[model samples]
Target: MKEFHDIAWYVKALSKELPNDIRNPAPQRLLGGLAYIIVIVACIVAMNKFDINLVEKLMFSLVLGFSFASMGLLGHEILHGTVVRTPWLRNLLGGIAFAPLSVSSRLWIKWHNTTHHAHTQDEEKDPDAWISLEQLVKSPKIVRWVYRLPLGFRAFVSFVSLSFTFSMHTMRMFFMYINEFKSKKLVVWLEMLIPWAVWFGLLFYVGFNKWVFMYVIPLLIGNFIVMAYISTNHRLNPLVPINDPLANSLSVTVPKFIDVLNFNFSYHVEHHMFPGINPKHYPLIKAKILEHWPERYFHMSLVKALITLWKTPRVYYKETEFLDPRENTAYDSLGNGLDINNIKFKKLKSV
Candidate 1:
């Protein structure tokens, strides 16, 4: 069995061919972020005022679900520095976008920007890799059953639970960061307090039931959609070794309509290789990659990918020992030393 370090050379060689100008324009990203917030606000206002019949509410809810889920694509763009030039502005916008969805911008930065991006598909290092069902079979029966759902439905359920999932992960990362600082824990307390403050404020200003109907329900629907979309992006692929990040991730060749709505997140392979690249540039990158390295890329239609995942017999995990500590250290260090300050938007003539 080859050790994990033995695979590092393969990953680096694959990534070396990636194009440089994969990022989107800053102004478009800002507009995209603002558009999501505006759409959410509009939906909330429409829901409150329309006094809609049940059928209408259902339609409204579907729209809300789609819009809310789509925001994840927007949030990702912001994270990549494609949404805005200023880091502070990006953080503020990213926070607002994630707040209703119950994700923390600060925490997402650490896990996504620092951890996942740096370590791509290394199962040991990348939390995004598919865990093998064999491991689940050895565990509790309930765990096995939960892991056995139809791919689409399972992905949908996971999407609905995203807020809770992200919140838990964020809190864990938050404490880890604070522990590193050895700082007093006022920030966590403040985070807890802010929600209550807003909840009570809404309850007092509007009626309690209205608060639940307006904010909580919409947020729940939105989060479900977000999670579903995210799961659709990468979860169904066969697990690869921790060192083989590219293989662990797959891309969906979505139709233009869904692509527009998803902000091109279906281009998963391209996104992973050049995360700093904006969604706006994804299609261009995809075209270029296909033109250059068609055989190397996995290009499946969205429906096909979902069907493939649905039919997959089992999620496989490749277990390999790492003989070269230096290689692991090198991959880990690549993302740790990111020059976040210099990750600003710059115009590139071509891919």
Candidate 2:
């Protein structure tokens, strides 16, 4: 198979054909996220004003959690340079937006927008890419358990892991990848401090029981919202040496209301194709992608994507083959079963 190395030519051609609005900066769309922020504040106010009971607090926390996650996505768009190009304002808004998960906008840009986007599914460079079976075996026992507990054998219980995966990875990237961005360390410290102070200070002020319902659990919920998409974004695709949005990314379809709430985030491949473009215009871009590369694009329901992710092993034996080391079983990148067992992986057919 001929590898295209990069999609620069395709993007260049498509750029000329796209509507001008796709390139225009629409900061106003980000303003909608303010409503989520407002709702979170409102939830806090209600807890104090009504002296809410446990049941009422639970309801408010659910709203707060969803609002936190939703607003964070808006911040994602902001950080992506989709709108608001002012350096200070962009980081400020992004910092606040990602507050629920205690993510530093500066570090996030380094980890996500910089590294993850550049590397995509590159096995070594892309932090989020699935590891090879050899690498998995070399990993610590606890790390192996981490994969198996949620994404490996008993995958049905993965939600427990997903709820905090974003939070875990954000800190992991911070501690692990901080050396790469040492110059920004000071700002990242301030960025990281803001969320911890707000959430923990609120906890001490409001009491553990109250804080757990209001902020703690809500933050966990926010993490779940973020990871649910993150997990499905690229894991199903083959780990290519080069970045190929069509082959290395999968676009999950959400319902109309979710598409609106999530800032059109379900259009994963479209966003990867043009991360800087306003997500509002992603559907149009998606249409253009289909027109150009119908066979290359991937779109599926959110539920189906999650189900398939659960059924497959997290370790890669081949670029397109997933394997469970314990079972000697093989599945394709998309979780379709392969009929080979106890056979050399080289003899296995390409998915």
Candidate 3:
């Protein structure tokens, strides 16, 4: 296994090799932002203007989900301040981009930038951290069944799980801060409310079926796609104490189309290592990583990786193993079998 020193030395070398033009250009940001807006508007205009049938609307729902996911990922880049220069402009763009998902930029920053980035694989702090075997073992039957669903269903479950988690987390935080009237909290509360207000008003105008087909279903699917990236990115990785991106992060090798749509999220390790680096420069950073680590760096195509995760257990049993707590069996990320029952649980912590 590579130690912290190995990662540190690589990072130092990487910093020296990175080009001065690593930041995204203004034209690229403007064109990309405009394209995203057009796609979103086109989807909405189609739903409103055409007398499309249910089947077609369902198909459109899938497209709409993809569109929203694309926008959400762009918003991620905007929030990172890698897509533009001015801070307020970046925040404004981020708010507009995430409005479709009803996720507040402030709330997302609190959870993602402040918490998850700071403690990527720490089970106790990172909300996206690995699930613990012992916690899954003690979970109720229904909960276990949800986790034990068939591969295809399990993939869907992973997506929907994130949708519910984010929604509930936001609501919990909102209520917890209800009494506080600080300007930032108030702004965040308003930002959180605007999307829902527009949505509910539209629901009254368009009726339930139209709203579901055009908005809700697609929104859920979009959330799922986002969660799909989040879940598979770090699956079966160790819960380490060190802030070594190479050790804890797993980058997915996605196709160009997926990279475009996801704003190069598959280049996750690169993003984590240099948070300020823009998506356009990910390929270059990835090349640098490959030059140094070659065979040691982790990456896989999105679909195959998700399928592997679905087949493998979600509960971490050891450094490179996961336990199917329901069956009391162990498996690697590739679905290879192992006998981990003899493994002591004394050191295992709650998820």
Write one digit per residue (lDDT tens) for candidate 3, span 227-250.
778777677466665767777777
Query: Tens digit of lDDT per residue, candidate 1, span 224-340?
Result: 545444555555433344534345456776668878777777777767666766777767666666675565555566666544433332344232111111111110111222121
Model 1 has an lDDT value of 0.55
Instruction: Note the Cα lDDT for every prediction shown.
Output: 0.55, 0.79, 0.71
Arranged by TM-score, best first: 2, 3, 1
Alpha carbon deviation, residue 313, candidate 2 (Å):
1.1
lDDT (0-100) at residue 101 of candidate 3? 82
Instruction: Indicate which candidate wins on lDDT.
Output: 2
Candidate 3 residue runs with Cα over 4 Å from true position: 5-10, 24-27, 134-183, 333-351
Error of 2 at 93 (Å): 1.1
Model 2 CA deviation exceeding 4 Å by range: 1-5, 144-153, 334-351
lDDT of 2 by residue, 157-192 (tens): 665788888888888888887777677778788898
Clashing pairs in 2: none
What TM value does model 3 have? 0.84
- Backbone clash pairs for candidate 3 read none
TM-score of each: 0.70, 0.91, 0.84
